[model samples]
Target: MNKEYINIALADDDEDDRFFFTEAFEDLKIKNRVSTFKDGIELMEFLEKASLLPDLLFLDLNMPKKSGIECLKEIKASSKFKEMIIAIYSTSSSEEDVENTFVLGANIYIKKPNDFEKLKKVLSEVVTTNWQYETSGLNKENFLLRL
Candidate 1:
């Protein structure tokens, strides 16, 4: 709710990906607090007990214990996370993945970028956008973050 800082959460299995995500946020001008989770289970545990839920959640599709698709389904099923903006942050940009996540109620679908600067740009755009308005006009066309 506070404009001063944004609460961002990422659930990814890869250690390097998690580090890059946190680093990208650190490089951005936006004030944010990022929490990284090694897997979906850890992410779910934190969300369950957390009083202050994250404003934005980036989920990776593949994980050992639980997958991002599973996490997305669970989060959407619960009314407690209705206000959260879910972003499918994964390396796969397959039509099936995009279609599935869009149908499952995720706000945005972002394919992991190969370059660091591009990642920062993608993150900045996602963070600075007016999600309130963006969600209202959410569609398959705009669902996948192209840049």
Candidate 2:
């Protein structure tokens, strides 16, 4: 078995969602180094630390301490971490929330699936697609150049 690890960071307040996400990732047979943050504050703290940046981020909009929107703003504002792929993975299907997330520079906004089977499928697709894309290191200057 090729144990190639993919680093993924998740910022969500719901423990059940985190558990399900981890299970789904495992079921996909994806070698992943998954890190979970209870809320945006913890996520921001990890991101601020140079050693903790992951290859991808899954953010939930409604979180305590600091919302995902706030975290997105902070991450995008920083030249050091702006290029990291930040995806808004939330239960919210509100068009306003989706539009705001994209307008604030989120790479994508994904609706959270209710069923475990559906969630697994969604996660598998996301993981596969993310690896297929070539993502450079997080740097605002280079990100803007590419865009």
Q: How many clashes does the backbone of model 2 have?
A: 0
- TM-score of every prediction relative to native: 0.98, 0.83
Clashing pairs in 1: none
- lDDT score of residue 125 within candidate 1: 91
Strongest candidate by TM-score: 1
RMSDs, each prediction? 0.8, 6.1
Q: Per-residue CA lDDT of candidate 1, range 55-131, in tens?
A: 99999998889999999999999999999999999998999999999999999999999999999999999998899
What C-alpha lDDT, on a 0 to 100 scale, does residue 96 get in candidate 2? 82
Worst 10 residues of 2 by lDDT: 138-147
Q: What is the lDDT of residue 109 in candidate 2?
A: 66
lDDT of 2: 0.78
Candidate topping lDDT: 1
